[model samples]
Target: MESPDHPLAAQCLQTLPKIELHRHLEGSLRISTLRQIARQHNLPFPSNADLPALVQIQAGEPLTFANFLSKFQPLRQFYQSPQIITRVVEEVIADAAADQVRHLELRFTPAALARAQGFPLNEVMDWVIESARRAASQRGLSLALIASFNRHEPLELARQVTALSADRAGSGIDGLDLAGNEAEFSALPFAGLLREAKQSGLRLTIHAGEWGGAANVREAIQDLNADRIGHGVRVLEDSSATALARERQITFEVCVTSNVQSGVCPSVLAHPIRGMLAAGLNATFNTDDPSISNIDLTHEYRLAVQELQLTLAQLKDRVLAAARASFLPPAKRQTLCDSLEIELAQQIST
Candidate 1:
């Protein structure tokens, strides 16, 4: 695919040090790596050309929730062993470094990784934690892992994952996230588990108000106690929810391209990021599924400026917001926020 014609904006955005708070390891795999894995594992695929159409959103395809989700069905086949999982984790960190993401909180579904080969959940978690630490140290990026549980899954599995995440809180895994089919499954079932996780010192983030309505956002904040929201762009639909978010200072991780591709919004220009900002809601830009959406952090920043008409100052503020909203401990989080403020000030002046 050809690059978009935004030379100066893209250059400036690419050069700015950024933070990513919402990225999925399952959706961040490279197509080339997928092809190589397919050939090595002898998966049933006719040719390399057919891989992108199956794993990525195409131009001519329908941009519905089902089509966007169908891409992951084939991806589940690739996590067949331990080595492949580690390789994918390393590559994800490298990609973030290439995009100038100074800090990243990459979330992954353990069930998705373990169900393919019937690997033990605790073993999969161990591999991800060790692999992520090694990769982050080598890449010189501040990285943290969040174990995600699907709301549609059973409560027992959520409990197991939450217990594991809490047990490894300071070691590697720092947060717990509720993700999956918000349009169909309600987040109410796992509210008690999330609260307990929070009490156990694990931060919380819930996927709400994207496929569902603003009430889901309210429940996430008021009941589930989400420190940050994954895609709460639809919070504007209800005045009460908007006011509640503003009152509590909850951060929203807004992904522009993902919303458009998943039919959450009509188009990129129609995203409610600007509205969220106007309402005094803390908002940050992120790439929910960079590879699947065919974008990077820089691309999303450029889109915010050129398409959504966000000024450079506003974009800089959003970057800082993400840094502050990270799931790191108090001392580490402040250090990161302070360093980013200094760096972003330098970038804004030039």
Candidate 2:
């Protein structure tokens, strides 16, 4: 569905290696796969369940936050089982491969579904890690996992999740995060947990300035000392927060479609993606809830083109920013960057 004749889209479509720095494993499931899982598990599927179907484009506008968040409930049902979760992880990787993604860091709150399924947190993380390992081997794309603590949960549970990430430091876990409804929780109480994860050598990223304001992003950076932000688009509202992020070179995972869908920004054109880049802030595109939003890596890239009108070099730079923020080791990071340069050269040659 991308236009190769369009320079930006052509550049994005030419198998140039990319890194998806922010994505949720459960949110990226294939729609067809969702239906198949429902059928396989003998659950009644939703009437609006077809992934390939064109969602009714809201007349004259896009989805509001409440409306957009509503679609996730049915999608959440598919994530309740270990088998389903593993399948989603694998399928998400394969989906990213379609757009030539070379590396990705998938984040999710394992505790939400683990508690729902009566399973322990570590067990759920193991299944996800195993799935990621196998998917990487098969797809030839590096992958990393960031465990998110749902802010809606009690602060004690947040501490426990971060501790679990600390305990599994040697394994596949790469980082700790705080997410889910920034409006409902404060960042002050989670400092100790984030500190523990950092002490254990895991990185920290948090969802901020999405539903909340620029002050939340400030608190996340100053109080929580986050390495990256999940959706800090609102930082553009405050000169100080924006300056601080640029000064610190804190990467913001910008999900354009997700922002419009969640009503964080009124339209894709209103997204702070290009503004963030122009302001010297590190910005990367991602598919926050691919299934619910009915989008993929290619679609997100296309929005950056058709809506934001970024140049090929800009898109490449965005991908590079993602690679830099990726949870891969230093050696692998260099390997990926070198490989990307080579591939881009090859594409331009032909």
Candidate 3:
């Protein structure tokens, strides 16, 4: 539904390679797939459930945070079986591949998946790990999985998720993410635990400065030891936070439209991504939840050019910055950057 055809969008941005660092698995479920699975499995649902409206932000819908989160309410029911999980994972990776994302660091909630069927937490992790591996391999897109934990959930459960990610660091999972309601829950409770996950070699990315304030960004940088900040557009509110982020050179995985649609920002044109970059913060564009927000990375790129006033060359720099900021290890990250650099150059020339 994010089909844009602005006149200035003459450049083949979709053909250009991209790097996505903040996409969510639960929020990426296709409505058609959800309906199909629900029908095939005969899952219980309200007889009057408007499946599409429940899972997709409808046109003219209130762009409030409540309305944005309402989409996930129905999505929680569809993860009934291992095959269902695999199919969704494969489909998400395939969707990214079709968008020409050269490298994607997708974060999924193990607890969310497990809670659906009373599935064992570790078992749910296994399904996603293996599914993403096989799917990424089949699609020929470089993919990394980040085990995500909800901040509103119990701390012990977060510890379990972190332990699971740390246990399988290089094998399947590459990073650990702190996601969910930042407006209501404080990330301070999980600080020491996340720091240990980082020390154990799992990359750390915290969702802060979106629903929360600039101080939260300061805490995420100083306390959580984040390698990247997810939707950190609000980091520019306080000079100290901006200065700290700049000094640390923290990568901000910015998703522009998601922030607008989620009521974090009033609108795309008023988004603070440009301010984040101008303040010397390491900022890169991303799609937080393409399916839920009715968008893709291409829509994000086009939005950056058309609304955010970012030129194509500046967008190219952000793409390479994202590759450098990826969760891959030093040598492998270099290889990915090398390959992407070549592909980008070839595309630019032709």
Candidate 4:
């Protein structure tokens, strides 16, 4: 149905250097890779299941956040060992590099993996950090880790994970994030943990207002002092909150298809990304769960440019914004910025 020369499709696939600020590590694994890993582990996978149908579940009419979250648990079997985690990290980096993503901020909940594998939380953190270093070296892409806490988990446990994540400032695990179903629990419950995390010099990025409301986004910034928001698409509903986002230059990580698949937004056209940009809010596109959504950063960029009709120049700026919001060091940030400019110029000249 679509061809390379198709005007809109061509514009969407422009090979611009990209930066992914809000990618879930577990969610980014390639579905084929997921199957391979399951095979390697001798884990049960349905033989006659609808592969394409299951992979593109998000592309269906619409799905609730609960329905979307259900897909993640089926792949939990592969996340048991540090070796597997390390391998997944390497594969994730390779996928990003293949997508031409120059920078990535990956989020994961260490507690879940630790509990699954009978490993301590700190040990899991150590393995992820080490594995990330190896992956970065191979791809030459900057990567940062954001340790997450399941919202439904005990508040004290979340606080502990936050403390542990912040304890290793210059080493790895750059920040703390509160993730999982936003509507299932209150962000207020973790306010104390977030405050302590900020005090320890670690940055904060929270998953708010995706399935929740603008109030959740408001509280994440006001209460948790979140540096950036993960999928705060609902912020447009509250004029005051949206204005504050613009005033503070708070970044909102927009995952287009993911929102539709997760029922956070109704349709691709109904997405509020353009509205947020029009309101002067800082927003950038990302693939929240590349594996689950069956897409990648380049695909998302294409969707924004083609289906969403964002100009190439605007997409260029969005890539730059993603790099700026990422947790990379200043020197690395400049390198990414320079790479983006070079790629943009090349695309134009071609």
Best by lDDT: 1
Q: Summarize candidate 3's per-residue lDDT along 1-350 as a digit string, tens digits.
A: 11134443445687889899999999898777887887888987644367766777788888888889888887888889989988899999999999999999999999888778999988888999898888889989998899999899899999998888889988888999998899899999999889889888899999999889999899998988898999888888899999999999999999988888888899888998888888888999998988998899998998888788887777778999999999998998999999999988775542
The per-model lDDT (C-alpha) reads 0.92, 0.78, 0.87, 0.81
**lDDT measured at residue 97 in model 4 versus the true structure, 0 to 100:** 85
Estimate the overall C-alpha local distance difference test score of candidate 2: 0.78
Number of clashing pairs, model 3?
A: 0
Writing each residue's lDDT as its tens digit, candidate 2 over 106-127 gives 8877875576467887888888
Estimate, for each residue in 125-151, the C-alpha lDDT of model 1 and write its tens digit. 999999999999999899879999998
Winner on lDDT between 1 and 2 is 1
TM-score of model 2 vs. true structure: 0.91
**Model 1 spans with C-alpha error above 4 angstroms:** 1-6
Instruction: Give candidate 2's total backbone clashes.
Output: 0
RMSD of 1: 2.6
Model 4 worst lDDT window (10 residues): 47-56
- The superposed Cα distance between candidate 3 and the true structure at residue 219, in angstroms, equals 0.3
Q: For candidate 4, report its TM-score.
A: 0.92
